[model samples]
Target: MIPHDRPVMAEADIAAAAGMELHTWRRRHGSDFRARVPVVNPGERLRLYDQAQAAAFLEGRPIPPAPPAGEPHPDDLLSTDEVAAALGTDASTVRAYASTGYLPHGTELHGRRYWPRHVVQARIDAGDQRHHPERTGAGRQPGDPRNTAPRGRRTEARVQEVAAELARAEGEALPALTADELAQRYAVSRRTGERLLAAAREYLQQTGRGA
Candidate 1:
């Protein structure tokens, strides 16, 4: 049976549960492991961990014990005031930073801003990820987890070339093939296919129709 209900576990079991190689786990958290966890059997080299505490440490969060009955617990979403406190600044300053794209991912609702505590904290730890003009979009920044593009692949030029080819072949009318068919036809990944189609649509919208 799995040791799912047992919160405190042996080192190897903890590593397996966390889906990490033992060596990697040891290397990453060696100091903390030694300091925080108890040695179940020093003679037999058995180390133990509280799964919740270990998981929090592995994820780079604070390792404090659970809050007392009356104390408030921290939430994942930090309000503008909470974020300001974390940054050693004021709420208004945080709003300005968010407006200028200097802060990490945030959402605005009912005129109040909420930042992902971990994301913003990570950025602060790495020294504020400064705003880059090329990264801003309607709702997200380039460093967002969902905003990744494949590395070392430049497809805009080729997409434009394909658009021109289709333009000449069809005479001012873009091809009707859907994104999936275009992916299969051009041997590009679905994401690249979508980009190509988007470029084609923009081209057609601005000028005449294309691929």
Candidate 2:
């Protein structure tokens, strides 16, 4: 009986040894035997995890793509539809805003009117507060007599002078002046200078002298 048990135990040991040998062979040769074994290095695994996280975070969201570099800023110019969308209104409301001076006046380009995007955005940020009676402080209302129109008239005259100077410098072509040059000449802020230049350009166009 002891001899019989020894042979059975020997058989079990042989089976265990065969299993170990098979595992070792698989480790050495199974890689080449497979058609394609996915090998994910640490960097690739990390990237995959990051992508999964980002995908999860962006789930159920429809985000717009970022604008390309050097592309014109959306705040620089707006289409009628864009203005309407921003204002939570329709295109007709935007047109009315422009006509009523609530929004900046726009120019017709290629038969489509486009507002200066910054101006419209500024007005919107101001809560469409232009000419709001409730927002008016104790200070005199716009066009009040206490405020001298002469100052504005003087500014207008100065604008025309600047325009003439520009015309003289570049002939009737009326070359565009840099913001710094306009500010130095007109004693105005750079922003004010830009507005003045825009107004002057409008004047030139109306008078058929913009050539």
Candidate 3:
């Protein structure tokens, strides 16, 4: 029982009360929120939180009741339905894989095969990423959802900026910036800078300003 005077709770208690994993709670409610909760430690690794703040955070939120003691964590074992939804495949396919000992899991739980989350994800990652059953024919097609180009008035402005950066280097012994330098300046990847330079050169040529 918590002492009424202090009413401090640990991180584990917070997680249990919030129905979330420790990491999940930390991710969703970061340092700023943690400060609001007023987590404190007197040079110790263990953090103590104010119970009032924690209760306030969960005041209006609806959370499912925690499973009975001795049950496994919700994340420890995943149902075939969950695995199917995650992998974008049907349950039967996942079941078939599990039946053939493909899924890295142990015995079934409550009449459903429970795949170890990490193992199932590892196997899925090792396989083809574009092998979703519903997207077989459209995976490589243009206008495919995956390949849609960025659109908006900002595109032309971006292209102009890249062109200006390139033009600043014309007739100079050293270029205005290398691809890596441009990437750093614009916060884009080096490959993106290279592609932008290529497109900028084309745009300049079309505008009769070719270098």
Candidate 4:
């Protein structure tokens, strides 16, 4: 028995009766609603999606950034010219040093020679003075007064005793004993012992006793 002209309630009117607007109710509680929806340009949608995925995967984690471009490693080898520049010397001097075993051997790459930077620096710091023996009294000329000495049987016996003692203690054959060890045994300073040992070893080597 309804009247044919009566107005039917619209969905909006029904929602209003329930204390909400239909559009707002659908936006907030609709079964098909989405939260935090992104609005990206068609051209940028893929990029945005990739970024979102990366961010989600990396959440609560930290990663180190890559090294800057063109940075050199600490252990990188250096050229001979580079080594000379670092040591404040000429390339010829570097070669001479290398020949005398004062410096580490260099490598040839693509027909160019190079030395390790750290190895060169370490040898430099070690005060390797093998290149200039004349400056260190290590190259006394033949027939020099320092080469001649008063020979006595007692002196010969003492030298042999000291040499044997050093060889036994170190378990190695000695062209000569080190100054520090000789000084400890002789109750003398290292410098004095070094002078005496140098002279004795030189004489012994000349005589082919400990060659």
Best lDDT among the predictions, by candidate number: 3
Candidate 2 ranges beyond 4 A from true positions: 1-75, 129-211
Instruction: Report the Cα lDDT for candidate 2.
Output: 0.45
Q: What would the per-residue lDDT of candidate 1 be over residues 1-211, giving only the tens digit for each residue?
A: 0122334555555566668766676677566776875442243212445567667766668775732233222335566666767776555446546544567548642223467666566657776443222434444444532233333233554455446545533531224545776565444577877788778767766775632
Q: Across residues 1-211, which tens digit of lDDT does each residue of candidate 3 receive?
A: 1122335566656666778776676667646456555553333224555566667666744332322234333345555565767777655445445534455544452223556666666767787553254444522333222233344433454566567546534522223546776565444589977876777888888887666
Q: Write the per-residue lDDT of candidate 4 for residues 111-204, one digit (tens) a residue.
A: 2356765676686687744323343343433432223434354345335545544433332211345788656544457886776576566665
* TM per prediction: 0.26, 0.28, 0.28, 0.28
Candidate 4 lDDT (Cα, whole model)?
0.45
Worst 10 residues of 4 by lDDT: 40-49
Q: Which candidate do you rate higher for lDDT, 1 or 2? A: 1
Worst 10 residues of 1 by lDDT: 66-75
lDDT for each residue of candidate 2 in 123-183, tens digit (9 for 90 to 100):
7778643333242464434532224335666567656645554543343122456667666
Ranking by lDDT: 3, 1, 2, 4
